[model samples]
Target: MDWQTTKKDFKRYLEFERNLSGNSVHAYLNDVRKLEVYCEDLNLEIEKLTAQHIQHFLLWINEFALSPFTQARLLSGLKTFFNFLQIEYDLTANPCELIETPRLTRKMPSVLNIEEIDSLINAIDLSKPEGMRNKAIIEVLYGCGLRVSELINLKISNLFLDVEFIKVEGKGNKERLIPVGQQAIKYLKIYMDDIRVHQSIKSGKEDFVFLNRRGSPLSRVMVFIIVKDLAQKIGLQKEISPHTFRHSFASHLVEGGADLRAVQDMLGHESITTTEIYTHIDKDYLQSVITQFHPRS
Candidate 1:
């Protein structure tokens, strides 16, 4: 079958069968398209592709200096695509079956210390009309360890502020309740009651907790830009984004002796392995723990 036809089928399978999010489906398609381009230059047919052609494509992409993590993801996407073909078309063999994924080095996520977090939040210009809204955004992001998408899509109906908890829809449309700190709840109330109540909210957007000046919910890009601007305003050297607040929240919780399972549930991580990255504590803290808690020390 042709590349376009096969890709259309793959998209359907991803959306309906696998139930992947739109962003995930887009990423997988983009990965396949890269290989499709490579094959097109060589006059290779999608159905007739062999393991050797896949290996050559990997080598060619390596010349572009793609990171191992990206390379591994590309290979994974291809493997999934070929597996789908095998099931649908009854292909005798899967070309990606024997292929080896590139070994990836796990990089530690960047985290902000409490002081840095305070500085970044304090740098917000409270004189501006959106100042309390921005402050509440940061507080929710850090205090609740919410993803940017979750923070943007947060709804008024989901907030249980009376009991200090919030229900956020996470990846795969799963919902989780995260405990909100008093500080976050305080700013959220100020934003909702004082600032947001006075604004003319757009129809169908009144339920959203955070909104732009135009009465629309904030976009993910806007959240990233806000975080970037705040970082620059505070002269923070660490390259960070909205996700950095999440990392800081998890790191601080781990450092403060919070249970890993509790952190995992709060962060809405699917696996404990995904949440284990926060266990990489600094050596100074490790030494202090041993000195204080170990009998031999």
Candidate 2:
């Protein structure tokens, strides 16, 4: 198959069959582009690619000083491509079978302390029209541990506020019901009753929970900007994003002794191991828990 045509088919497979997010699809395509460039430089077509060519391409990317994590990530995309070609297109042989991914170290995610969380939340200007909505946005971000995309796409119909839970549509279009904290529910109600009810919502966006001044749904970038502005208002020095609140939510829950499997379900993680990355407990807290609870102590 030709390079462009094969790549197009691969993208369709990722979108339709795999149900990967747009960003994920783009990343895989970017990896394929790198391989394409390498082959073009050697006057070799996609059909002519061999295991040696794939190895040399890996070497070329390694020379750029990319970290092991990035290399492994890129190799994952390549593996997906070759697998698709083999299974779907009935390609003869897959060169990626023998290729090995680099070992990756599990790095801890940055989380905000309770004091910092309150400070950031309190920093929001409550007098503005979008004030209540932004406050609710932060609350929901932390409360439900939602991704930015999930937050933006949140629907009013999915909210089960009466039952104290909200149905979250997460990655891969998976839906899970997450318990909402009282504070999140409170601000969300205020935003809905006071601001959202008064605004003339855009036709298609009427279902979205959070909306902008124009009554259209908030974008992912707007959510990032909201988080950044709040952090700056509180003079928080640590680098953080919307996802930081999600990490903080998971970390706080784990620290409070929430069940691992429960947290995994709330976060909509495909694996419990994915949820484990958010856990970061301090030594003092552990010692205190042991000292208070142990009979010998």
Which candidate number would show the highest lDDT if scored against the true structure? 1
Q: What would the TM-scores of all predictions be?
A: 0.91, 0.91
Q: What is the lDDT of candidate 1?
A: 0.93
Candidate 1 residue lDDT tens string, 1-297: 788988999999999998888899999999999999999899998778899989999999999999899999999999999999999977677788899998877788998999999999999999999999999999999999999999999999999999999999988788999999999999999999999999998999989999999999999999999999999998899999999999989989999889999999999998999888889755446887899999999
Q: Per-residue lDDT for 35 in model 2?
A: 88
The sequence of per-residue lDDT tens digits that candidate 2 reaches over residues 25-49 is 9999999998888888889977667
Measured over all alpha carbons after superposition, the RMSD of each candidate to the real structure, in angstroms, is 2.9, 3.1
lDDT, model 2, position 139: 94
Shift in Å, residue 79, candidate 1: 0.9
How far residue 178's Cα lies from its native spot in candidate 2, in Å, is 1.0
List the pairs of residues colliding in candidate 1: none
